[model samples]
Target chain A: MIPLSHFMIISAALFCIGLFAVLTKRNAIQILIGIEFMINAAILNFVAAGRFDRVAGGGQMFALFAIVLAAAGVAVALAIILNVYKHFRTINPDKIDTLKN
Target chain B: MSAEQLAFYFFASLTLISALLVVCMQNLVRSIFLFFVTIFSLAAMFVFALADFIAVTEVVVYVGGVLVLMLFAFMLSNKELLSGLQNIAGGFKFTHLAGLLICGGMLFLLVSAISAADVVNLSWIKNGQAISENDNTIHQIGIHTMTRYLLPFEVVSVFLMMALIGAAHLSRRERRS
Candidate 1:
């Protein structure tokens, strides 16, 4: 049987991948997808943690709330990105430098 | 291996692979589609992990609702975006190395902690088939969400409504009249 450690490790790897994507990708949508990946990794970790605490199920409940929140956040972020695209005619976040350092 | 372990492997593999595809694919539409696959697999894994309420919410809010909205935005935005794509040759190298180091260190810490901890008897896996029991069931989740977590739940609902109104305002086209 695959232990909880395995799940945690895989989720950690996925989280790393998502971080890498967010850092490296220039497209706003790609970054959003990466953000989704990161959140799901946390959800996976929570579920794995919740397996032992089966009575209160706090981890599972938190995970459910987190999933909803992630979706809402992504929805709003995408809308902003789309608005940025309309003004800029491109979605490359690196080049959209209206308020950059 | 038991059915539980087998199911875990199947769903976990699907989720991870699809997630990888979501990040790696070059085409935006293809990446979005892969994202749907990833979310679906994750929800399935949550269900197998005995988080039935979470699984349904994940599928409903993320895969169904949010993804559709993202797809709509993609369609509304410009289509010809080939030249704008970045060449990942140089810009991300150092950031990627840093990310690798951070993630690897965190993984090492987590594994060591799990191995060193003697706080709980992890040898006792919960009854995987006993999800129907009232303590961890959907009924308990609903009751707790309404009673104990009522304040935070309402707060989140208000936050969501605010977000919706703000998004509509932000994305609205300017009137030229």
Candidate 2:
């Protein structure tokens, strides 16, 4: 049987994986996926923390808000990526150097 | 281990594996698919953690709704820019090593801190203990939204509206003269 500490540890590992993905990936969409991973890790932590917090359920509620916000953010980012693709014909992110003075 | 602890391990493993795939997979579509799996597993974990409301939101908002739209956008922009092996470094071995070391250190520190702390069960952390068990879960959330979190909620709505307008403008091809 797993322990709460194990959940916390696994969440930490997931968070690290997401962080590594965000830091190492060159593609914008991949980075976005990393961001999604990070958010999910946080949400997992929150929900787990909320298990013992039945009264307020603040952590659980926050996870809900986070899920919505992540969706919104991902949508906006994809639109921007589409624009990036249209302009450069490439989405390598590192290659989008026109705006970078 | 206790039943709660056992369930925690079960779901935690699911969350970690899917999350790893979400980052490591090279194909964008596959990556997005893994992202959905990760979120669903997380929702399951939330349920196991006794966060029914959060679990529902994680599934509905994240898996059912958001991931679908994101994958649709990914398909729309599926030009396959890089050859998946262009000038990219061949797995920066040193960097990967360094990252692992640092992450390992961080993990050790976190576990130690948690263990060392004189912690007790935190059930008495808040007032109005019956709030979670009440039938008006959504209704109570709404009340809190207006009473305490109204400003942030309104801002998020505005942000969503702006994002919608911006996406529409950005995606529309201008009629060339």
Candidate 3:
């Protein structure tokens, strides 16, 4: 039997990778991609831990909701990112500082 | 190691490598395409974890819906996106090191916590066989959603529709002043 620790370690690794991408990447879409990775990692953790529960499957239900919410979030974020690109003609967050420091 | 162990390692490595490339590669197109592989392999990992329903949903909702949408967004706004792609090697900034440090620390902490908890022999492992045998995750999920999780299910549907409509409205052409 594959232990839960294996899955937890993998999910943690994936989350860290996503965090790295989100922190260092220059493009807005790339950051969104990192966010997707993080969400998937969290979902994997949920499903992995949920394997213990035989009756309720609460973890799977939560994963399902998380996936749906992620899709919706991506849709809205894409629309907003596209609008930002239109206004600034650039997707790099560093350059589009219209809010001013 | 057993076949299950080998397969789990295979899919896990595939997901991790592709994810690493997706983040580290300088080419935007390569990263985007690699994201497909990463997500698909992750679905396989979901299967390994016995999340059968989530495995299918991950593929359908992610690969079918989200990926295509992202691809279209990329094609629509092709310019200025790649300018940042080639500059990674020109100068390694402090942000890069900071990112690496923070992520590495987080991974270390997670590992330490996992080891401390003794998750391999949890109290529930006595029923591990029963859990594995009852692989009808879809059926379980359906019953729970219909009975216990009915409210959240309906709420999520409403949330999804609202998001789509809002995205459409937001992305529509703005009238000139």
DockQ of each candidate, alpha-carbon based: 0.49, 0.50, 0.74
Tens digit of per-residue lDDT, candidate 3, span A16-39: 999999999888888989999999
- TM-scores, each model vs. reference: 0.84, 0.81, 0.94
Candidate 3 residue runs with Cα over 4 Å from true position: B87-90, B124-130
Clashing pairs in 2: A2-B5, A2-B6
Residues B1-177, candidate 3: write the lDDT tens digits.
Answer: 999999999999999999999998888878888999999999998888788889999999988988888888887776655665675646788999999999999999998998898887786755554357556777778799999999999999999899989999999998989
Quote the positional error of residue B102 for candidate 2 in Å: 4.6
Q: Which candidate number has the best lDDT?
A: 3
Q: For each candidate, C-alpha RMSD in Å?
A: 3.7, 3.6, 2.0
Q: Model 2 off-target regions past 4 Å?
A: A1-7, A52-55, B2-4, B82-95, B98-102, B116-143
- Local distance difference test values of all predictions, in order: 0.75, 0.69, 0.88
What's the alpha carbon RMSD for model 1?
A: 3.7
Give the per-residue lDDT digits (tens) of candidate 1, residues B1-177.
889888888888888788777776767788888888888888887776667778888888886788898788777774776433433323546656776687667667766775676323445454432333345468867876887677767877887888888888888888998
Docking class of 2: medium
lDDT, candidate 3, residue A89? 82
**If the candidates were sorted by their lDDT against the true structure, best first, what order would they fall in?**
3, 1, 2
- Give the 10-residue window scoring lowest on summed lDDT in candidate 1 chain B: B126-135
lDDT of 3 at A4: 85
